[model samples]
Target: MKYANNIAAIDELSASEGVFTTAQAQRLGISRNALSHACKVGRLERVAHGAYRLSGAPSSETDELAAIWKLTASTAFSWERQAKWDGVAVGGSTAAWLLGIGDFHLSPYRIYAPERINSKIESARFGVRNVDEGDMAWMGGLPVTRAERTLADLCLDCEDPSLVEGAFRDAAAQGLIDSTKLGSLLDELGESKRRAALLEPLARALSASDQKGQS
Candidate 1:
């Protein structure tokens, strides 16, 4: 099959973000060999196995995660997928970093998915969990754990107590999350030592933020 507007079609598939999976290409009737040919001729750049970015497509910070997420749906187009498709979400420290909640520039990108994704990409660590709708948000078409949920999840997974404290303070200070809701969630998570340690600092931070706002 031939497409007169091949690059245009790919642009649409990538949502103008410059990264797409082979499955997306196939949906447009562009075959694996065609993608290879495009790459060989400098029209496309293969970033990962079964993943390609248009050579001329502009770059963005979200490109890497978006590419990997698309691989989760190898044979379906984005619109064809369910509204909360596959229960995939960017969570934990990575979510905090994306939201600029704290000083976190973590590698081995943290992800939450309903099942294990055996992709060739090795730079990510996936946790199997169901992300509730209210606990997640969409950023540039990528699903992410919302601020409260991100911090709550971090409190559970982050090894460094200080990091969680910093994220919690940042989220509270910046009004990125509802302290009341987060407090309830932490309580529901039970009275672990970590939760206890976080609660005191969270109270102090919120108190300071409130005073500053009033002043």
Candidate 2:
């Protein structure tokens, strides 16, 4: 089966680097076998089972991370699609990036969805956690933990208490999350005593930082 037109279209879109799949080839009026042949001939590079990226494009660590996140979100579980269908937002580490809260330090990007969907999807690719409805909000067209919840989640999982403190301080300084909200999230998370203990101090520090900022 000929794939000259498909190849041309792919090459045009990926002048630098882009991703596509065998299914996409069929959608574009090309044969899957032809697409596979193109990959074998070094015309395409297979990044995952059904995903391919252009060969010889400048790839960076950030690009690799983003690709991993995309793959994990797409294949690791159905919760992501469920969240979209339910009109819930789903983002966490990525949200922190947008909110400028602080660096997430290799933490898995989080997704927030409706309570009805079970959020457990384990993979070596990335971490996924479910947030309650009240704490979920939309960010960049995806559901994510609210700013306060994000800060609390980070505090619960981060290795360095100081980093969590810094994030809380930054979020408060920027007025990205309210101090009262942070306290409430910490309180709500109190069932996990260890987590509450770990984050309470950071919350307090953030309150102090907010005061200093106000002054």
Candidate 3:
């Protein structure tokens, strides 16, 4: 099959690092048949279900992650859901890795969403949780947990408390984490005794640092 290049769609993809979704194409008045024709003619590459990258466009390190995120809301373009993007984001150790604050990586990428996700992909895992807008940040055009929240999640979910401590130190050194904001998150997580037990050491460390600064 032969087709003309969807110049308008390509222009839109260029603005978003050569990535676009089916819904986005439709929004530009390109039909599914047109998109499929573009793919067949080497004008586009389907990266995931409903996600595409312009053919020959430079690939981004975050392309796979971004495509996966788009699947969480296959019907809505990313910019249209800026209010929170359905509360979905990269999270846990994966988030720390993206933020460059930890020497940790999970085999299955960790993603958090407001509701349960039954993903069939072997390389991704999903967790159901509510994330506040303040706890989210942008990285490579995808949403991810901020440093403070990522550390707090590690403190609660990681088996090795030392790993959380190390990540916290790294983030603090890079000025990516605010001690005051972390303190509040710790207090909020401490409401659960089990969580408090896990977070106590970090909380104490933060307190000692505050005291030393005064002295």
How does model 2 score by TM-score? Answer: 0.59
lDDT of 3 by residue, 24-73 (tens): 77767778888887888887888877788987888876676777787777
Tens-digit lDDT track of model 2 for 74-152: 4322234445444334344555665677666333544434344343333222334456666765443334567787777
TM-score of 3: 0.85
**lDDT agreement of model 2 with the native:** 0.57
Q: Where in model 3 is the C-alpha error above 4 Å?
A: 1-7
> TM-score: which is higher, 1 or 2?
1
Tens-place lDDT digits, model 1, residues 144-206: 898888876775674465777788778776778786677676576537676656555544555
Highest lDDT model number? 3
Residue 100 shift from truth in candidate 3, angstroms: 0.9
Give the TM-score (vs. native) of candidate 1: 0.82
| Per-candidate alpha-carbon RMSD to the true structure | 3.3, 5.8, 2.7
RMSD of 3: 2.7
- Which candidate ranks first by TM-score, i.e. highest? 3
Per-candidate clash tally: 0, 6, 0
